[model samples]
Target chain A: MIFDLVIYVLIGIGLFFNILAGIGLLRFPDVYTRLHAGTKCTTFGSIFLIGSVILLGLKMWWEKDTNGSVLALHSALALVAILLTNPVGAHAIARAAHRSGIKPAQAVIDELSEEPMNVTTDERRGGD
Target chain B: MIDVYSTYLIVVIALSFCVILAIVRVLRGPTAPDRVVGVDTINTIVIVSMVAFGTAFREIIYIDVAIVYALLSFISTLFIAKYLQGGEF
Candidate 1:
């Protein structure tokens, strides 16, 4: 009984934050700000979402259901996949946005602007 | 026991909310890459939801689909980044 309650609560909490992530994405200004809202918020929410699934699976497994064990284990793998990939993907997107000339909102300084040009001829060709 | 149908309904509704939020970003994003980020977030959220649905429905196949989706999305993200970096393929 207690376990089911805990699962329900965890799922609810996860759902709440996932919705918040969407809201933040809508409300934030600029690409970077929106990325901040969209990526980090969803990642945090997914932890709980998947965590709840893990709990559910474990419960099923404890009930001696073979399929339940597999589901739980596989869901855990999926969670790990999300945790590893989401941040890396976010970083890539942010870097790409920066390189593609999407400047941060209300920015006063860009320290990377001081770096000397390192563009090879190949890059110059590719840029065309 | 809590009603299983209710759990699935809540999960679907919550995920739909997320997808709609991402749609706003994709539509309003000023830059191409911003839209890409929105899409990527959507992809991640969908994967999680797929797993949730799989568990709720007692179907393992959906979980497998989620796994594949995660990997393919990662590759797509990398390719997009490479394109933005102006690097050779």
Candidate 2:
């Protein structure tokens, strides 16, 4: 009974975040900002959503269901895959946006590009 | 026992709304990266919803399908980003 309630809560939380992410994608301006909505929220939501599945599997296992073990283990692997890939994909998209000449909304200067140039300058001065 | 059919039905409906919103963003996005991000969001949501449905149905195969979908989606996102950046292959 308790586990069922917990699963409900987790699903509720996860669904809420995922919905927020979708809205963020629609409402936020620019690529990077949209990414803030699109990437982070969904990833966080997946943590909860998938976590519920993991808990379910554990619940089954506790009840001595043989399939519970496999379900829990597989769900964990899927969660790991999501954890690993989602952020990296987001980062890559952000970098691509910057490189492809898509500037942020109301931004000043790009510090990332300048940082490399600054490093080169320091190296040149040190050589002198 | 939980009523999974109803539970997942609601969840799927909610996520479909999200996907529609993302599609709106994709359609109206001012820039190319904007569209790409919209597409990426859509992809993520789709994968999660798939997993949710899998659990609702208690299907092991759907879980593996979700994992594979995630991997393929990641690779596609990376490639699209690379294309956008105009970086070497």
Candidate 3:
């Protein structure tokens, strides 16, 4: 009984954050801010969602079901992939966005703009 | 009490709604990076949905596919980012 409750709670939390991610994506004005919402919220939400699945699989395995271990292990693999990839992808996209001349909206100062990096003259001008 | 299987289905449905929301951003986004952000969000949600679906149906293969999809999507995101960077790769 409690097992079911735990699963329900986890699923609810995951759904809530995922929905928040969607809303943030729509409402945020800049690519960087949207990346903030799109990347982090979804990654956090996926952890919960997949964590529930892992618990469910473990429950099945506890009952001596043969396939449950496969379910749990493979789900763990998937979760790991998400954990590892999401942040790296977000960082890459953010760097690319900044390098390609998209500045943060309504920002008074950008520290990165001060650095004379490898960016083209046009991109540097855009940053300014 | 509601069936757990039914609950899983509900989760998938809700995630589909999230996907629709991201799609709206993708459509309305004025900039390339903005659209890319939407696409990245969609990929993450899809991975979660695949896991939920696998649980609902007791199919291990679906979760395996989700893992593969996650990796491929990550690679694609990186390539797109590199393309946008506009420097020699």
Among the numbered candidates, top DockQ falls to: 3
Q: Summing lDDT over every window of 10 consecutive residues in candidate 1 chain B, give the lowest-scoring window.
A: B1-10
The clash number for model 2 is 0
- Which candidate comes out best when scored by TM-score? 3
Each candidate's lDDT (Cα)? 0.83, 0.86, 0.93
Give a tens-digit lDDT track for model 3, residues A1-128: 99999999999999999999999998888999999999889989999999998998899899999788898999999999999999999999999999999889999879798776656778979999
Give the per-residue lDDT digits (tens) of candidate 3, residues B2-87.
87756888999999999999999999999898889999999999999999999999999999999999999999999999999998
Candidate 3: give the TM-score of chain A. 0.88
Clashing pairs in 2: none
How good is the docking of model 3, by CAPRI class?
Answer: high
Query: iRMS of every model, one decimal?
Result: 1.2, 1.0, 0.6
- Tens digit of per-residue lDDT, candidate 1, span B1-89: 56743586579778988899889888988778878878988998899889888877888999999999999999999889879867567
Indicate whether candidate 1 or candidate 3 has the larger TM-score: 3
DockQ of 2: 0.79
Q: Please write out the lDDT profile of model 2 over residues A25-86, one tens digit for every residue.
A: 87776888899999899999989988888888888899999777877888788889899999
DockQ of 3: 0.85
Q: What is the lDDT of residue A27 in candidate 1?
A: 83
Chain A of candidate 2 compared with the true chain A, TM-score: 0.86
Give the per-residue lDDT of model 1 (tens digit) for A1-128.
68768878888888888888888877877777777877788888888888888877787788898887888789888888888988898888888888777778888876665466556667989998
